[model samples]
Target: MTEETRRKAALVGAFERGAATYEQLGVDFFGPPGVELVHRAGVRSGQRVLDVGCGRGAVLVPAARAVGATGRVVGIDLAPTMVELTRAEVRAAGLSQVQVELGDAESPALPPGEFDVVLGGFVVFLLSDPAAALRGYRRLLCPDGRIGMTTFASQDPRFTEAMQMLVGYLPADRRRSPTSEHDALFATAESTAVLLRETGYRDVHVTDAAFESRFRDVEHWSAWIWSHGARSLLEQIPARRLPEALAEVTPVVERARAVAGDLVFTTTVRFAVAVSPG
Candidate 1:
């Protein structure tokens, strides 16, 4: 399969597996940090908002509430399962103004110049062509619209260390040589700034926030990994080695927990916001 096809398959498989419990696990993992980023973006009533890569409506639902009944929120995700999950969530919440569609962030299949605001959480780094995606988003906005995105910052030593401990068990080819995915994309502020400027966004600002999360224990961490795409790595290991892999990673989890206490772990995220030229 082509690289693009492979990435799409991987994303589909990951979200499909996570969908059943995404609302709970996703909120537990990302809700607070994402909410803070959206809150900082200052979503107001009567604004039409577009949520790109709206995984399970984690950001879209809250954003709909923030925008009130007078506004509308549209959520789009590449994965059909993710879109379905988010749609169900919007229904369960009794939110009439929120809609979820299966669509690509790189080339959102929406009418031009409709949205007053675009919000993306932990999405920019995942796009194969982030600049092109931003350019597309710029066109979707109503000239003066603003975009807000959240991504990892600083490559938290604790998180990196945890991921590194798992690398040994993964297929050699699958091992990520880069320390962090975010670094692979926006390694420097200047690079990110340049990309934003080139994409025709102005008044760009990047800021940071940190939050803590707790797992009951190593078992909980293991479950989280298995449920969220780490299972692919486990599949590469021999059945006999699976237990060893889990055992080996237990200490890493313990270390992260000890370092972070009952919180289990702490991570700092960077949020970038830019305004489309009027």
Candidate 2:
């Protein structure tokens, strides 16, 4: 298989494996920022929207509401489980205008000149060819339509420290991120805006935003991290050593809380938007 094909498979595999936890932990935790991004893109009533990598209807549901019953919203994801979970939410919410389909970002089957807005939250950075994908998304918009995306500006410092502290528990060679098998993702606001302009978008702008995730204490923090992508780091420890590793990581969290609070984590993200020429 080609390198890009391999990269695409890895993205699907990682998210598919994390699908359950993502919906369980991510929907509520991530909803505000996702919704805020669509709002920044200026979604309105009677407009068609395309949410690329719509993980858990975080943005999809709000976009549907923004467009009201008169608009159409389609979400495409690389993981079937992710799309299915979001579709289930759509059904539960009675959003008949919202549809979820299984597809990759590299080639979302959306028709050109058909959508008024395309929003991708925490997704563009993961594409194997982000520039090419953005170029395609640009064509999907009608005259004067806009596209927006979100990327990590930085992780909460405590979380970053906690993660690093966890790495210290592992044996020497196995300490790197377990999720390294996936493609590299862009990680800053300025760089992302530059990419949008380079990919044929006009009037590009980047906005900085942050959201907080709280845990009652160290134990609560441990449980939450294991539920999502950070579980990759925990997987590096040997089965026998896992318990001991957790024991070691506990002190790190304790020290963090002393400096901060019982448990508060802040994730900073960048929301970048660019419009198609008329």
Candidate 1 runs further than 4 Å off:
177-184, 229-240, 258-263
lDDT of 2 by residue, 1-278 (tens): 98667655755676677777774643245678888998899999999999999887778988999999999999999888889888998999899999899877777876789999999987777676678888888778898889988877788776777688778877897676533432233545666777788888899999888887666777777767765556656655577877776777676666555455556667887889889873
TM-score of 1: 0.90
Q: Which whole-number lDDT from 0 to 100 does residue 247 have in model 2?
A: 78
Say which candidate scores most in lDDT.
Answer: 2
Model 2, TM vs. native: 0.86
| Model 1: per-residue Cα lDDT over 198-277, one tens digit each | 89999998778777677777777667666644555555567888788778766666776555455267777777888999
Candidate 1 minimal-lDDT segment of 10 residues: 176-185
Q: What is the Å distance of residue 60 in model 1 from its true position?
A: 0.6
| Model 1 lDDT, full chain set | 0.76
Give, for candidate 2, the lowest lDDT window spanning 10 residues. Answer: 178-187
